[model samples]
Target: MNNSLTNRLGELAKLFFKMGVISFGGPAAHIAMMEDEVVKRRQWLTSEHFLDLIGATNLIPGPSSTEMAIHVGYIYAGWVGLIVAGASFILPAALITGGFAWVYVTYGTLPQVAPLLYGIKPAVLAVILNALWRLGKKAVKTSKLLVIALGVAALVLLLNVNEAIALLIGGLLGMFWLHFPAKRNSPEDNTNLLIAGLTTGATLKATAAVGASAATASAANVSLWQLGLFFLKIGSILFGGGYVLVAFLQGGLVEEYGWLTQQQLLDAIAIGQFTPGPVLSTATFIGYIIAGVPGAIVATVGIFLPSFFFVAALNPLVPRLRASKWTAAFLDAVNVSSVALMAVVTLQLGAATLLVAKAPYVDFVALAIALLSAVLAIRFNINAAWLVLGGALIGWLFFTLGLYPIK
Candidate 1:
């Protein structure tokens, strides 16, 4: 490799590896951190381009943030950068989760991380809000786009629509609404198109359901190959987000195969949630429980392989999509809708982090951390990784001093 290419690869490795360790909260938080690093701090991409990547990543099935890392890597380096960036980000999370899985298998219990999460969740909210503010400016370029964003947010926050579906709705809305008066199509043609679209969507969902059921019925010994194939299928077709993986695993692993109990599944999800990087790393925990180290390695590789492929295929088309007026409108709407989803998630996280269910009803300390973190990030331009670490330290201190009760 040339010296310049080698240097870029080194940069990708350093940046994503650190992000893997410190990216808490989930995909939204992870994406937010990436935006800060790639767009704001490093200037590796413009906010507009970053927003496009987010829109495109949302349209895909795999982990959005991990794909974003891979997308950024490709933009910076090449196909090699794609693999390096993805592996660098994924390796730390997989290793950390693997260690947790080993402990869970050995001790039959999980670690207590409530306090660390208590502080980290609020700080993550701040980081997400900062990203939303920055990206929304670039995305909501017109009043119509703003309306589409709001409509998508309502679909998700009120109607409980899936986020991926919401993005599709936004894209379609933007496509037709923004590209009006250009051409006229027969009403019959429009109706047929709508019907075909709906039919295709329904067929895909039904097919996935049937596939899951078939896999359940055919459950057998958890061989390395079978486990890898199971996750590979999921990585290719599983949409919505990592949380949706639960239903599939519950049905296939717990109900059909008896490979994992309900509690074990829940604990695996818990470990995935609390740890940094992709929630799909829960596959690592489950694989360790079901098979062994080899299973964990296979599962991690299988579940993440599709994202690398998907991003590589889609990244090159983004600039082309922007080049076409109709597709450009669609991308614009998708971009705004992606931002809207992040907004809704941030609000949900805020409520969950700042409000107590029982006595007191409000977590003032968390609120303070969120507010302070936001101020630092917005005004002082503090790095997100440090903010997350600081939140964890504060949470630990509070827990140690008996200031904050463990959740």
Candidate 2:
């Protein structure tokens, strides 16, 4: 790479590392941090391009924010940039959260940590709401897209359909709409060649093979190996965003393997919101709790490896793919389904905090703070860190005023 490119990549790596460490409040917060660093601060990519990547990643199965990081890497420094950016962005949060998981598992209770998380969850809710609003404004541009988004959200809330399947169906629907527009509909505009080349299964399979190889060589433990393989399978087959992965993780880790308790799993998820980067870094926490530092490494790499492979394998063809009406339609469908998955997750979290769980009434305060934060975010475009801190203050105030005892 040339000097300017090399320097830029270094800067990106440093920024991503900082983000991984300090970027808390789940995927939405992570995205906001990224927007601050990459789009606004560095001006590496246009806002439109960033949204396109978000849309594309949302249509995929794994963590959309993580994939966006990889995409930014790809855009900035090609293949090397992709690896560095993804790895750097993931490592700090993985290590910090994983360390905490290790402590929580070994000690059996997180005494000081619980209060911090209690405050953070409300902020996370605000962060996610802000993200949804921003993304919705951008994604739901056309009337058709709005209809699709609303319809997908309703189906997810009511039908209990698998998110991956929902996204796949959406992609197919988008493809159909793009390819065979109605009389009043505009013709499908294929503008991205890279996405087009990904239409073929053969290319995806090859990418899978590469990902599998990377996964095997990157880790040590047999459990880690299994975790890697499992996540690889999920990443390969899944086609939505971070929220969809939650169900899959719950099934595989909690139901199938019995590696973690429901409580532990939920706690880990809460921790993910309190930290930064990708919500999927919950894997790092799980891995550490299960197997220690090695496990954390395995889980982090296992979870994110597929994104690199998919994006790299597909990037060369996005230009051509963007031009294909069929592909455009497919991506559109996937995008709608992805939002549906988010709606489902939000509902589930709401129910857990509001209806099902009795102990954590602090969640209500969190919700209120989140709502307030969302309003601030939309109206004033405030920074997420400030909002998160504000939520923390609310938590402290509630605890001090005897509204709820600090757990």
Candidate 3:
């Protein structure tokens, strides 16, 4: 490479690496930092073009912040910058989470650590609930979209349908129901159309769910290749943000394969929130638990690989994508469905974290932590990372003082 090109790539690497280390609070915070450094400070791209990139990332699947990093790198340093920027941004979080995974695997069962996790897990639910509320307001704009969200929720929450399948059903149904001109003159006709659409989608979800159930294998003998493939599929189809990932993991890992217990999944999410950069770093923690260092490596690469491909492919089509109504309709449906799925996962996690199997049947302290966390997050607009840390500190203090009993 020329000296100028090499220098530019190096600059890209340094900037993104720094952001990766400090970019906490999830995708929104990550993007705000990028905007400041890349646009306001560095003058790397104009605000208009940066907004276009954001829209493009939304059009495609993957973490929007990570994709934005890749997009900026591509603009500044070409294909190599794409790799460098993405890896730079991901490396810090992956490494940090990997270290935590090692510690968790080694000492998670100890009394001291258990209480810390006790608080963090419920706080994670609050975080996910916050994301669900924010995304739901934006995605569910129309009554038709509301019907779509409810339908997708029913499929996943009640029928035990696969999340990916439910998402596809929602998107396709939305494209047809929202985009196409229908001959519905009255409220009765509109209601009938929505009912028919939900019925058709449910039928499809049921059929897919049956096949999906039969195909799931136990993860007791999971191979690295299988692990990589699972995450790759997740990366390709994941919409909304990192919070949406719980739906996919809850179904595939916890229920289908039994690779992780509900508690383990909640712990993984808490670790992800505790770290910086993309929340998908939870993959690194999860991979380590399932298969050690090799698993962590494969899982991280597999889950992040799709984002690079998506950003590259979608970057060129941003203008066209932003103009198409059909694309907008499809994205709206998929987004609402993703939010709906997140809502279901949040409820499930709440039950897992706030309710005990014996005696009291409820952990009132955990419930109080969750309520406080939610108020701080929604009403007070506190950062999620702070809430997580606050929960950890409170749990540790409560346990140390003999106030909160250890389960």
Candidate 4:
């Protein structure tokens, strides 16, 4: 019996480890890959339950998708599962980013591997688009939900309202519409109230992260602890994945602290994207530059440590929230808002991705690949890793044939 349990734990570790290695295109893609594995392939959780977890992550600070992995780990295998899942998921990216850090420090330049990302980015877009479709179908169940989702998207994409604020407002709207439609509250509204209190408090914490930066004071010599603490704080606070991380790092490390230059930080972000797993592994690259192997270790731990605790603390409440009618409404609001934010990010990324320099018609090859991949995903439900690899090979062939020349 114990061996069977251990084997199950091993499976959890291996699954997340594989995901850590191949998860490209950032958090949306990572979450899509996870849904394929955990919900569709493994049947570990239903789609509805997974949506609840995703919504819960939005409420708390830290990397949302990474926290999703941790939450799944806890749900399936308890505390050990949480550790194994989060660490296994993070390990590959951290090591890859750490190696890049070594290369950067040794060479003073990030490796130029445009062909790989060129192929992978389009494929990732297809995967993310498919995931959004599936989750959006589940999230937007009511006309009211459709309105909330659309409103949040407009606020984020058009009005440029804060994403965190948009999500919180969605939750508040859910609290009223789902729970008190006629100004009548059931006894369980109190439970939803408690859940709302916890979620709002966490949402406020996430909102404050926008202004977060590295500790004040620039120095010619930077300490390992400072690097670790800086990333740890950002990891615990930043909510919108790599996009937000880029701005935070630019301000803190480049402007506030003299540890890295603007170019170096951009180089770090590029390397982070080129590798698999979390883009937050950019911390590993910067950490190794600042200190060394020890710095790499500390930075990775500091950034990810809070995710473990955040999941453990917030995950249990998801079921409680879903179990009650009122809090369930709250979860629905948060879920739609989460998917709405995903849509906004996808639009922004797609715009940036479809534009290519020195190419005829702005990255025609990638656009073709992305369109093809999207059709295949929708029609056949193909595995994402295969699409990524296939995209890479196609890009490499184009480069070799000089059909799509990289200038």
Task: Assess each prediction's global lDDT (C-alpha) against the native.
Answer: 0.87, 0.65, 0.76, 0.83
Q: After superposition, how far is residue 369 of candidate 2 from its true place, in Å?
A: 2.3
1-407 per-residue lDDT for model 1 (tens digits): 99999999999999999999999998999999999999998999999999989988887778999999999999999999999999999999999999999999899899988889988999999999999899999999999999999999999989998877888888889888987745675564455444424532642473365265334322236788888888887887777776688887787778876878889889999999999998999999888888889989999999999899888877887786776666777788889999999999888888899998987888899999999999999999999999999999999999999976866
The TM-score of predicted model 1 comes to: 0.93
lDDT of 4 by residue, 1-407 (tens): 48866887899899999889888888888999899889887899999999988888888777777889999899888888899899999999999889888888888777767877778888999999998999999999999998999989998888888777898888779767866766576678676668768667866766575665555655456777787888788877876667778888887888788778878888888888789988888888888877789878988899889889888888877777888777788889999999999998898778777886553647777799999999988899888888888888888888878887653
Model 2 vs truth, CA RMSD: 5.7
lDDT of 1 at 102: 92
Q: Provide the global lDDT of candidate 4 against the true structure.
A: 0.83
- Report the Cα lDDT for candidate 2: 0.65
Model 2, 40-144: lDDT tens digits are 557888655565565566545466677778888988988889999988988887877777787787888653555555676666666666565555555555777
RMSD (Cα, Å) for all candidates, in order, is 3.6, 5.7, 8.7, 2.3
Candidate 4 or 3, higher lDDT: 4
Candidate 3 local lDDT, 68-133, one digit each (tens)? 899999999999999999999999999989989988899884123576776777676676676566
Give the winner by TM-score: 2 or 3.
Answer: 2
User: Pairs clashing in candidate 4?
Assistant: none
The superposed Cα distance between candidate 4 and the true structure at residue 67, in angstroms, equals: 0.9
